[model samples]
Target: MNKVIDINADMGEGFGRYTIADDERLLDIVTSANVACGFHAGDPRIMGLTVEKALKNHVGIGAHPGFPDLIGFGRRDMSLTPLEIKTDVLYQIGALSAFVKASGGHLQHVSPHGRLGNLAVKNREYAQAIVEAVLSFDSSLIIITEPGELAVEAEKRGLKTAVQLFADRAYNDDRTLVSRKEPGAVIHNQETVLQRCLKMVLEGTVETVSGSEIEVDGNTLCVHGDTAGSVDLAKEIKATLIEAGVEVRKLEEWL
Candidate 1:
């Protein structure tokens, strides 16, 4: 194989009786699961159950933390102090850790969700706060994020880090993800997404929203579960990678 990578998907985003992603199906395909903590979409029971399922599927479990906005699904930006961001992240990770431990699985990574994650790409304060929390809590836990302020902060703090590339989001010329409110922010067409992935992995390039092709960096790919046809997309992406001579491996096992 010419390359080794990890396939990750967000899951456990359903609350109460509602469920989002086809997590069971995804767990079998993806090498890692970025599970939602309670603040966003999951409840205690959901979190616990997600952890158990991920463990059963031999998938690495990662804490997917975001703003405490259940209604917005943590996709909207929130105003908060550095302390608030840091503490909120720590609290969320701790909660997920409990479930992972009880389920006999180790927490492998921390991936900030939605808005918080996007902002961390450029906002130094937000990036620093998240890295500090991760360092204090579990330095061994990799921070799966795009190549930006968050990854830079993690490196400075000497914490394990993994470069993350989104399979379903468009990139800006600045290399940051385009805002969700903007046009073409999320890529939905299956063939376009597949071609984009191939270019990103095999060619190290992605066409930005401004119609510019730029170099991209990443070893971990995230296929957002909430998007329509995500389960099928994840499966195709995995098969495509394997067919292209890329090994699909877990971040915890290989990184």
Candidate 2:
């Protein structure tokens, strides 16, 4: 069987009349979309349109829940109790679910956004809260994230998970992503990023920041929708995967 993988991107990050990424064009390339659910960057109008466009393009839809920090785009750190994180996540997912249902598309997964996602990596309390929120909503929802505490927590709760490798970020030797604060953390060269994606799928490994390659078990590739020339990059990566005999499918159909 051909190696199967899913390509996902964060979409619907714009609010009001403001626009972020070209989500419409992104839907054409990505197999799954992690639509922002208002608390972070998206609003009702953008969420509805994003889900509608993604379903029309045969792309799987997912809720991207984040901390309620629109100013920092959910990247900055914040203090919140376990109960707060759980309820915040539930509210955000519910908000996005409405849009998905309205468009006649089922929600395929839930991916915690930005700070919340980062905290869940090593924070057991945060990870458990996210898992609890997902279970409370839909136990079948696939938790899409990088391999970390969140992945372990989700599996513990009998929920499926899809591991995603970032195409434009640097990784540490331990399979953790290099911090954005560090230099050379985010790669801009499309060729290099494309090579990393291929390695993660074909060889199950990626070169770390220390110039060492670590084995990675990734079933999905995450493309940044808000970056410059990202639409073109997504298109190129999709074409490259197809040419390499990899099946780029939706997360729902597989893991």
Highest-TM-score candidate:
2
| Alpha-carbon local distance difference test for all models | 0.91, 0.92
**Which pairs clash in model 2?**
none
TM-score of each: 0.97, 0.98
lDDT of 2 by residue, 173-198 (tens): 88888888899988999999999999
Clashing pairs in 1: none
**Number of the top candidate by lDDT?**
2
lDDT of 2: 0.92
Which tens-of-lDDT digit does each residue in 1-255 have in candidate 1? 378889999989999999988898989899999999998889999999999999999999999999999999998879989999999999999999999998777999999998999889889999999998898899899999988899999999898888998898999888888887898899999999988888888888999998999998787998988889988999999899889988899997777
State the lDDT at 113 in candidate 1.
91
| Model 1 misplaced stretches (Cα beyond 4 Å) | none
**TM-score of decoy 1:** 0.97
Error of 2 at 233 (Å): 0.6
